[model samples]
Target: KLRIRTPITTRMTGCPNGCARPYVAEIGLVGNGPNMYQLWLGASANQTRLAWVFQERMNLDDFERTLEPIFIEYKKSKRRAESFGDFCDRAGKEELERVVNEFDPSQSLVKTTAKPRVSVTTETMDRLTRISDIRGLSPSKLANEILEQYIDSLETTVHAQK
Candidate 1:
């Protein structure tokens, strides 16, 4: 179904030995257990980079249902005649992960809990409160926004260095 609906190659194996060359396939599935596999994606076109495992485990029965929506996005939004490897590269891992998240059959498998309270110096807390008040947001939300921006900048810097 994956090959029929999308122009990407998929390779699967029944064990972690990776004999199927899942590292180079557009969609790599290495078995984790009976009827279960670990999913990977974003291998470079030249096979210079191995795919990254995004899902640690998933049932084979969930494949089509989970991946079809992602293929639909690729079909509707990709450049004309772009191969899945190139499309995955162009879309970037984060965006593709967002598409995959929509069809996650194990959504409820993850336990959701309120974020734990973070420890901060009194000065930092006061500053955050003041900035958040001016921005019309809760202190926690403002702090999250600030952290996300910092992480983005840090990631860009780290990637640039490498």
Candidate 2:
């Protein structure tokens, strides 16, 4: 396991429909085919910026091997308290690509990338907190109910449109 200076956000989706909001994550992996994914990087930790495409079709099997060098450089050269996403933004995609391409696996620092997790937007979380407090319900329960309601509404709208 590699230790990072600050928490990094990672999102993975089965498709490129932005369902997981991968575009706003520091490390976004959108599955394009079996065992192949589109890699995105450079978004802010706060989800305020959009991550750009680092690779159109990276082999998922090579995920750790491909990112180890960049992770090493970030760990060694990043400014104090800088996050992985912030470091990626400052380093720029071209330079990061070069580092990845020129990396020697024999000099690997550590293996593995962070496991991906689903997350709600900050705004949604805040809203949930407020509404849950007023209704005396748990924030997670409220969030789930809201999501289910929203999905139902979307389905109704789609059926109406058709």
Error of 2 at 133 (Å): 42
CA lDDT of every candidate: 0.76, 0.87
- TM-scores of the models, in the given order? 0.54, 0.65
Error of 1 at 160 (Å): 80
* Model 1 per-residue lDDT tens digits across residues 1-162: 324354567889985888889989878999999879898877765677678876788787667655665676677677876767667777877787788677554533333343466789999999999999999999999999999999999999999999
For model 1, where is the 10-residue window of minimal lDDT?
A: 106-115
lDDT of 2 by residue, 67-128 (tens): 78888889888998887888999999989999999988777765555555458899978988
Separately for all candidates shown, the number of backbone clashes (residues 3 or more apart, or on different chains) is 0, 0
